[model samples]
Target: MYRNLQLLRSIRYSYSPPKASVLLDVSNCIQGLKQKLQELNELKVATARKIADYDPMPKLEVKMQEEGFVIKVLSQRSCQGLLVFILEAFEELGLDVLQARVSCADSFTLEALGNKISIS
Candidate 1:
């Protein structure tokens, strides 16, 4: 009968929850941090993919004509003094603008037909 009581007591103790330890707590915290780091890495990769797929460079096309050259510039972004910078470049190149169209509302666009200026 005493042996039976000891067996029952042992069974009860075995069924009880284990005591928490510092090592276990640290291991759990490390696991949680690892999961959070994985999530952050995934988010970073997704953002980088979006940025890689986007192209912000401006588009420029120049066609040579019989009398002059046709220049077309387009961009999804705008910068202050961009038009003035381009006009300065044209002046430096000594090109006389024959016809031109410009739009800077939301995007920036410039279509120009120009020819080299004759020096007398």
Candidate 2:
């Protein structure tokens, strides 16, 4: 009788379901880590693309004035090169740009008379 009782107890213990709560918690943690890593990678790629899109030329802002035209050309290009290009373009169009003021930056802004000037 005692042997039967011991055998029944062993069988009950062996058949008990294993607790899975700890395993589930570990799986959730791993999944969260994976999601965080993916987000970081996306952020890195976006930052790289933004950096690559940077323009080295200065922003150009052109305007006109009464005494001929005031050409304010802001650019990262060397002053001589910028002046040469501007003068060449003006010459090509047969419009003389006078009194140029240049500023330097990452991009250029040129403000000059837009082919609508009356030169005496």
Candidate 3:
């Protein structure tokens, strides 16, 4: 009885090493992350090039009010698609876009109203 019990205690669970599969999975995840980071870097470079074309530069002002918030952006006429950029940035910050108004002439003015959320 003692001999049989000793043999059962020394039994091999599996021939395959568990760490080998885990290491391979981690390596694949790392490769995927690297590809994603490369794409983001390329996007950053493209955005930088587009922004470099502005002449008078871009200005941003934010006013936090009791009701909500108001954001004002001033930029050269050459600067385009700033509204879309502003919307994206606001959404990223978990803000809700209430209304938007734009004025155009010698310079461009973008006024956006938004409400902030309590992120807890």
Candidate 4:
């Protein structure tokens, strides 16, 4: 057809594949960007599967108190340096520790109690 000849002429002059033609450069579809996207997708899927294999942990709940605050931290197993972080946060706020208690059970539950008073 005359249209096919015009498309061929455009391809020849521009050194690009004709959009209306059945011929296509395979390299254009599987370029470096495609390879990188495939790798990224694979990595994301693997990380998600690995994360799903772990047990789900509960979030921390803090209740305001007249003295300071009562914190109830629910975790599947142990507190991963959370108690230390809590103490450091209280210290950063210039709160002096009045009393503290940490209780653990065979059910792999950890409860930390901290009673702090503001020096100021």
Candidate No. with top lDDT: 1
| Colliding pairs, model 4 | none
Candidate 2 per-residue C-alpha lDDT over 1-120 given as tens digits, one digit per residue, 9 for 90 to 100: 545444544544433233344344445767999999999999999999987776566655455555555556555444547667777878876776544444546455566653444577
lDDT of 2: 0.60
**Cα distance off (Å), candidate 4, residue 47:** 20
Question: Could you give candidate 1's per-residue lDDT for residues 43-79 as a string of tens digits?
Answer: 9999999888766888999999999999999987787
**Regions of candidate 2 where Cα sits further than 4 Å from its true position:** 1-18, 57-108, 114-120
Q: Who is ahead in lDDT, 1 or 2?
A: 1
Q: What ranking of all candidate models by lDDT puts the best one first?
A: 1, 3, 4, 2
The order of the candidates by TM-score, greatest first, is 1, 3, 2, 4
Q: TM-score of each candidate?
A: 0.56, 0.40, 0.47, 0.36
Candidate 4's residue-wise lDDT over 14-106, tens digit each?
A: 455455442343344347669999999999999999788667665567666777666666555555666687678778866655555654342
* Lowest summed lDDT window (length 10), candidate 4: 103-112
lDDT (0 to 1) per candidate: 0.81, 0.60, 0.75, 0.60
lDDT of predicted model 3: 0.75
CA displacement after TM-score superposition, residue 97 of candidate 4 (Å)? 3.6
Best by TM-score: 1
Give RMSD (Å) of candidate 1 vs. truth. 10.2
